[model samples]
Target chain A: MDIDNISELIPQPVPLRDIDDSPGPCCMSFGFDLNPLIQSIEKVGLINPPLLKRDNQGSITIIIGYRRIKALKSLKADGAGCRILSGDDILPVECLLLNLYDNLAVRKLNDVEKGMVLARLIPWIKTLEIVEHYMPFLGLPSNRATLSSYLKIEEEMEVRVRESIACGQLSLRNAIMLLDIDSISRSSIIDLISNLKLTVNQQRQLIEYTVDLSHIQGRPIPDFLDDQSIKEINSDTRMNNPQKGRALIRYLRMKRYPSVSKAERKFKKMISRLNLGKTVKIDHSPSFESPYYRLEVLFKDGQSLREKLENFMREDIDSLRDPWKKKK
Target chain B: MDEGVQKYKSTKSILLQLKDIPVRAEKDDGPEEVACVSNELKRDMGKDTMHLVSYQGEFLKPCPGTKEYICCGYQILNVGTNCPLDCSYCILQTYFNRPNLRVHVNLEEQLGQVFQTIDSDPDKIFRVGTGEFTDSLALDPIIRWSETILRGFSERKNTVLELKTKTANTAGLLGSKYRDRIIVSWSLNSPFISCREEHGAVSLTRRLECARECQSEGFTIGFHFDPIIQHSNWMDEYRKTVDLMDKYIEPEGIIWMSLGSFRFMPALKPIIRRRHPETSILDGEFVLGLDGKMRYFKPIRMELYAFLNELLHQWHPDLGLYLCMESNEVWQESMGWRPETSEGLGNYLDERVRNFFG
Candidate 1:
């Protein structure tokens, strides 16, 4: 991993007009604002030279530091200092590598950008070297699977998704799950994640639920999600985002399994029928996952216990009767 | 087919002490099935590998129940930790941190303490079972657990030792004459779930046939549709199993039949996905239950139980049918009654015991 090959490209002042800002053959930068670059340059003067390439037309293109060049241009500087590659020496792969290496100092590459760059470098570089050296250097796991996923980030994902990745709002895993779904559902998921500020576990649950429900119902996730009832929760004005989220989850769960939802409604109704106040606690097992149910009644002494017992015994004990056991 | 004890490991010599059995020392580094790095090593897991490790924990623990449910007061006899038969929805896959088919050779010694504890409380019906952490009989061919435990409960007037299993490996039970208080139970699922989800277990017909054999031999048997999975035409599939049960089993000998829908810890979902990629068990709708396990929603659960309860009741009016780990409302809606508390459930089961054994 000798970096000395990049030293031959000497820094020289190139006229801002000579550098073509036209979209180059290998521009990976998207929507990167140069305000920080502009601010830094304005304070400390230009320190690091931008990596530029001179084409056969005798005009140099800003390969790596498009933001830096733009920042200099916005400051109305006539000339920009750049490490220039000239005359039949610069390969496109090297330009991609230099672009990747240049970002090593600027800012951390998000998974999407890292994926984009790794996608480019993997074609020519030996897979093992990239996995062992480049991947770890780029804060990625040194594995072919991870490298393959990052490679997919450039082509499978859209510009907005890439922006989501860059802003650290979307995870690569969610992005990958999103890719399996349609754009409409993907937007909905991304919206949920970004809006709800979904934790990692919640995001995973949401994605798995959405995908599995889609598979079961044979409907697109968003189509099922945008049902008439769920639409009300989504559009409800009285509820805050969290409340809406909770309500929508319950609605989605009900829609996903109609029988289970109905049972939940019935169980709640039964609980209300008990007429047990806050002191007289009654709760059923979670989804009947176990063989038993518990009834907890709070009492301080024998008097209270007897009272609670009386209340429980008096509350329509028909459901608790064993049909086979003879009455005394 | 006859089985052989080809390999063994133990922190004590209780397993090695068995005479006339050809027990060979395990030559592998140790049981590293969960952390094996190589693809071949991972594939080599569940490869007829058996370990007889010394168990350091309590041999008898209460069944893990949710505070909100009517958990049957079933006690677990910790004969082992992992099962030889790998069911797709088995909570043991997530319940255990270390992995392998490990038989606690110390179980024979611990049974003395367990029985002493049970004998001390003669009025309390300790409905103890050994299949909670492992199938009570799956490893019987290798470990011969029924031989060690049968006589201990042969005349225990207060307790009933249930040898619950899905395996047809019941030779150990058949050879013994101790039948005073032993219930050999089989966990039955629909044929679809049995064929698809329960790997390495004997088929439903064979399992019921084995139950028939045990029942004919003067052993009171039990049937458990403990993990009733919701599959396509599940009612038809389950009714097919019940039909076979009616054909093969005598209803009078069945002590109890428990119905439970498939429930699992959330952690098992990923493990199942990774370990069993071809499985369709996780394709159903699930929600996180109060106990942090993923369960089918209430309506779906009740629907399953209700259908089965009616069909089971139709088959036999007094099969001592009960729901395993269910709510009072579910019991009322599905089975027309509820235990309402762990003690009530225990009393109900004890009454079943008095009816069957008294």
Candidate 2:
């Protein structure tokens, strides 16, 4: 965009203009703020005169300076004069392009956003396309494979990430990595993340362990739920230790489709069988709140609850039908 | 004397040529007065912080492959190596060849390397950090290097940039439009170190105060306790640090908090002895690990972990705390948990960062 004489440009203000909310084909993101522009206007007194277009019905439309316009409105509301420079100068296509360029250039756009922007830009001009266009415009190479990878959505992994966010368990970085990982390792990864609520380093260790598992197993990483090995281990391995039992129970609970609704029911049944609690109390959150379900069992002060649980859950024990078992 | 050499009189300015020249005092010994300045003078000098020299070089490079099995899988950004501050136990003394700090002012060159690597593999989420080789934001205000780096990576989804430092110098990143794209992190330690070994560094309160400000500005903040020092009343000291963190900083705003016992290379001991003779960092009970770095024994490390873990859980159960360069067995003994692999840490951390800020 070429700049003309600063004196020749005339500024015009549209009073109480009725503009369409769903205006078609505008390059501005809805949440753009005008404070920076207001500061700019305060300093230089509106350097790039606001651009305006007129419709056949004589309605004035703002082609650029959305931020400038909003700042004026706020100024008017505060009982200050909405002092704007009226302009009659016609803005060239390059000028409109400059507005978009300035906005996109300074603000760093993420890979996905860049891809979406580039994909949208493809239709604007057909002849000058691909990486050459982006290279000149945004300093990004428009390689198709690179573009595709940014746009790729591993839905299962995304869901797990969302679940982590929901449960307050995982982070966005870890979630994204888990999504990109081989599907075979996703289950064990998900189990580790959700169960122990490991830190970033621990989670990384887990992924490294899974990668090693893949290398050693001679098979692709297994889906934690669908993997035959994990299932077999779950079924046959006795929860001999309390910690191990708790982990297994957690695995089972997570596996229960749509989540095990009556988590308290299992606790109640176990309590009755083992004479576990003197009194049992349960707390549930308000629908919108957290800890959707919680079960707390109060045992007698002198009771050896830790030992009792450990004895019942030993991996060597064969059957839970009989709590008493000894080696031959 | 040449004008360039005359202009660079102080050890501070001389150190700026670290990457290029071996820094030596004019008196043949060292800059005794520069070394003797009270911590207060250092802070004053920070305001009119001198930019001695700038270099044109690649910023982010892939980690050099090590023959040793255990390596921190981190990519280095040669932004600014070594710090101007006189921290007695600073790893920069041994990490770099000379004490003079260097800031790669050739941002375009740095960006060229970074964008090249990131563009090459869009599918792979690379964990690249500037703090690995330099204080990521130490020269932030004067150079605005981190701002430039942040701007460069802001558009890429596959890369997460971590600007780790002990300085609260964040004027360069006050109002980042791409706040989600970068993580502003701090290296945390007990208040004792804030007064002792960490000379010229901001106080713990000031550091957390800055973190609080960053969190308010919608930046994902991180805390690192790499080299969690062993000392008398270590648990109490660490717990106090965590409690203070909980008080000043919001847990959700934190992306990750790493725990690492203080480990040192055998070669670094002499450097500390010669340079910072008064430092007590090498005084603690430590043994050589498989990696051959002197470390606190397994039991001491475990005790520190267990106490810190409980305190962190009590403070914020959701806070992401992971150990740095620790074994799976250590993890199990301390936290009663074993991560299956290295990716477990990366994946969990990635998930936590994304989920927390996605």
Candidate 3:
């Protein structure tokens, strides 16, 4: 804990191969590109030496600067200067805290990296302690639900999905929905989402509709996604990606709610048959949940409004009954 | 000793009797534990557990009704919170933060306060019920709530106590001599829904048989066709229930029957999905209503109500049919008339009370 030393601890030139470079228990870096660090080291020869901890077996582990070592190795550098500490001198938790603080001071961690930090802390600290002290330090809301979500993400999600989330391709909310299903179905849905390049709203609808359909139809989500109509929408050449995404959602929604869709179609047909002028319009509430229909006339003045109302009164408005109702 | 146990003389006997019943040590696959989101709360909702607490709130409170719809103006006698039954569509899944079968052991001591409130308004008819927060008779065998509070309400002229339940455990009520102003109501649903959705509930036949037994004993009865769902051949399914009612129950003895469609707050949707994964109750087309709960579309609701109205009216036109938490438009369209407001609906039900008990 003595930081104001006259001269720092001795820095030694350690062979890169001697150190275990894989993300150790202390590492919180994930879904990162090493090329930028490699290019930086290539230009400015490693200014701050990485931290290493040597065990009793004389094996070295990188306590900090995991990305630096990975970058150095990628650049074919055989050795780098690193400060060493005996593993007995510092506890594993202290080492983790050192790495965490070191990373926090420089750059913000991605969602996956934050999960990694919380996961690493779980073994050494109580949940409440973590929620109170460390969660705020990691810039997360101090709640058990959020903590459970992060733990599940780190412990359950595959590398590809985590990578997608870390790189800003998929949202954390949508990824949580994927966790409720099996891995095969999750992968298929993830692939479709990526290929279609769905927006956040579209991604949510896609997952919700797919899950509801699977439960209703008593089939796996992958099987439902493999339907011929869905594939046709995906492979349609004339439609763009956004159009296909919309068409896919429309197809699934129609399948999920057949009665509502039929009623909507009938209502639209009936309204078109009325053919009131372009200035006058009739609109039903969302899903036709309300009993009353709205009438709007875009008139320029009182005389124009009166004329439109007279025209509306002349139409057979009583035909505008509940679409599902039969004619008397 | 807690005040709840010290004040109520029967709490000691109830606790002694509860010790004889074997409770599951671990949580079961029940709806109460499944609906819990937090681990702390889940642990609190122990399997088949009971808690004796002196309820601190008012013993009698008005039913919390929204102004967006017609309300029956029923008074809720807070006998307890939570229930022994685990019906899939229960709103109590998320209604309370605390969990367990909480029996207000001080209910007997607080009856005078409740009566005072009712007696203060001499002209107002208190259509009181105990089944709003919990089932009326599900735990009656052990708790003996009927023995404590039945006579008090039965002796009152301006008040009627209705014990609504899905269980056929009416032994305590039948053993009692208080039947003048007491209405034993059964929540009736279609047989398909009864078997599939109403977990731990008595069968439709058994319930109807109980009603017949109660009516034969000179007790006026009521029925609620609430949450009338739309399913495959729903008309036929409900008609089957009606036919069974025709067999076991007399139409003349029934006082009032309520018809309501399936509606719930949005928060209960996920809880229902999590608890009842294989349930088909969520397959209907629902839209947000004016009161912020998800309900079936207007036309669908009209279809359900109109169909049941015709069937019930055919059974007995004087069965005093009414709709729960519905709009004036729905009442007019479905039942051929409208109560127009909550007060109007309350007056109608109060009239029913007077006609039955006066």
Which of the numbered candidates is closest to the native, going by highest lDDT?
3
Ranking by lDDT: 3, 1, 2
User: Candidate 2: misplaced stretches above 4 Å?
Assistant: A1-328, B1-58, B62-72
**True-structure lDDT of candidate 2:** 0.57
- lDDT of every predicted structure (CA atoms): 0.76, 0.57, 0.86
Cα lDDT tens digits, model 1, A1-328, are 2235666666888899788876564555665777988999999989878878787888788777777788888999999778877637777777777777777876777676677677777668887788889999999878765776676667777777778877777777767666655677877777766776665655766787777777676678778766688668667899887777677666666666665566557666667777678888766556544445578888899999998898888897565322212344
State residue B17's C-alpha deviation in candidate 3, in Å: 0.8
TM-score list, all predictions? 0.63, 0.45, 0.90
Interface RMSD (Å), each candidate?
Answer: 7.4, 22.2, 4.1
lDDT string, candidate 2, A125-182, tens digits: 3423545565346556545434333334222444444445434455444554555455
lDDT of 3 by residue, B210-314 (tens): 999999998999999988888888999999999999999889889899999999997787667766787888888777888899898877898899999999899
Off by over 4 Å in 3: A1-10, A55-63, A132-139, A274-279, A299-318, B1-10, B20-45, B95-97
* Candidate 3 chain B least-lDDT 10 residues: B27-36
Candidate 3 structure quality by residue, lDDT tens digits, A174-217: 88778777899888888998999988888888988898889888
For DockQ, candidate 1 versus 3, the one ahead is: 3
